[model samples]
Target chain A: SQKIEQNSEALNIQEGKTATLTCNYTNYSPAYLQWYRQDPGRGPVFLLLIRENEKEKRKERLKVTFDTTLKQSLFHITASQPADSATYLCALDILMDTGRRALTFGSGTRLQVQP
Target chain B: EPEVTQTPSHQVTQMGQEVILRCVPISNHLYFYWYRQILGQKVEFLVSFYNNEISEKSEIFDDQFSVERPDGSNFTLKIRSTKLEDSAMYFCASRYSPQSSYNEQFFGPGTRLTVL
Candidate 1:
């Protein structure tokens, strides 16, 4: 069985500071890793996706890094703002034993950017 | 930009009743999926549909659940007998492709199903 863990507590920080969220997994070999942003009462929006071959990926102010050797992925929001306050989820492509299928998921970490 | 859309933003149904959640995925997208999030729980995958058939489904998707693309525009999930435990926010998502390319799924606002 595989376990994905993220900081369950809400991350509080002053606006404009960098917010780093960690996602660690165990007992599974993922084909790819992804990060998503979910606001209350809304569906998660895709933020970034990084493959095992790639060490890091970036889009605008958001960045994601995947280290398969460590079975971990970290999502970073630099120059964070109040608007960036939301729950962030890190999902991995869980391939079944057949190795042709995958699913997306993560427990999610709550983030609160204080003004 | 096109987005996935779901109807009946909120639905409350009695236990054992049948409920159908509807979604209209992005027109050009080929892969469609359903996921649910119980309050205070992680978002869990329900099923994935591609090319008019189920590609993969999670263990949580039991016999009580079924999916349909009744028409060209609508993708639906029908619960034959809704249980109280089924109460959760159901999200509908779609992706353009899943064949080793830039496969990203676009999600809808979700329909909150409350089974009482």
Candidate 2:
């Protein structure tokens, strides 16, 4: 069975500091990996997506690195702020037999930025 | 910006009752998906729809669950007989086009369903 795991523990950091989250997977080959920010009781918002061929991707203050060999991805938030406090989820794109793509999400890691 | 939208922010119903969650995805999106997240759990994919048919569905999407694109813009998920375990936040997502090598899905606010 395929499994996606992230740091179950919440990460607390001071504002302006960099927050790094990890996502690891096993027994699955995905074409791409994406990161999303989810607030309590709200839906996930897209962040960054890195394809299997790409080593890293960045969007403004956010950066994501994908290592297919290691079966892992790292998400980094630079100059984090209190508003950045939320659960960060990592999703992998799984191609279905019918040529459709669906997302498989990890348990997610919660980050808290203290001011 | 156009975004996916779901109706009925929250719903409460008794077990074995029928429930229909509605969503209107981005008009130009070609793929639509339904996912559920239980309290404090990871988001689980239920089913994916495209070309007016189901492309893939997870084991969680049993016979009791069905999806329909009744019209061009409306998509719905129906649970014929909801169970207590069915309580969760259901989300609707859309992808602009699968033809793109990398298309990120846009998610809606989600509908919180509580079965008592």
Candidate 3:
């Protein structure tokens, strides 16, 4: 069975500091790894996706790095603010037999940006 | 930006009763999906629909579950008979054709189903 694990259950950091979250998986080599932001009681919003062949990807203040050899991904949110406080999820894209893609998610890491 | 929309933000049904969850996906999106998350648990994929047919389904999507695109816009998931374990937040998601962009999916505000 495939297993995905986020680094911690929750993280608290000060505003303007960088918050780094980790996601590790075992028993699978996914084609693409994605990150999503989920506020309490809301659906997850897509943040970024990095292909297995790509080492790192950036969008604004967010950066994601994929290390296939290590079966790990690191998600960084720099210049974090109180509004950035939310649960960050890591998901792997799975190709189904019918050629459609589905997502398998990890138990997300919740980040709380304190003032 | 067009986003997926789900009806009945919250639903409560008695055990053994049937419930239908409805979603209107983004107009131009071609792929549709259903996922559920129990309180404090990871979101789990239930099924994927494309071309008005089921493309893939997870083990949790057993005989009790069925999905249909009843019309051009509305996609539905029906639970034949709800069980206690059916309590969870159900989300509807859609994506544009893989050819156009990163197959990123847009999710709707979920429907919280409480089976008592």
Q: What is the TM-score of chain A alone in each candidate?
A: 0.93, 0.94, 0.94
Best lDDT among the predictions, by candidate number = 3
Listed for each candidate, the true contacts retained, as a fraction, are 0.69, 0.92, 0.89
Error of 1 at B72 (Å): 1.3
Clash totals, every prediction = 0, 0, 0
Q: Is the docking of candidate 3 incorrect, acceptable, medium or high quality?
A: medium
DockQ pick, better of 2 and 3 = 2
lDDT of 3 by residue, B1-116 (tens): 78899988999999999999999999999999999999999999999898889989998999999999989999999999999999999999998866656678899999999999
Q: Per-candidate DockQ versus the true complex?
A: 0.73, 0.83, 0.80
What would the per-residue lDDT of candidate 3 be over residues A48-74, giving only the tens digit for each residue? 999999999999999999999999999
TM-score of chain B, candidates 1 onward in order? 0.97, 0.97, 0.96
Residue pairs clashing, model 2: none
Stretch of 10 with least lDDT, candidate 1 chain A:
A95-104
Regions more than 4 Å wrong, model 1:
A97-99, B98-102
Q: Estimate, for each residue in B15-102, the C-alpha lDDT of model 2 and write its tens digit.
A: 9999999999999999899999999999999998989999999989999999999999999999999999999999999987756455
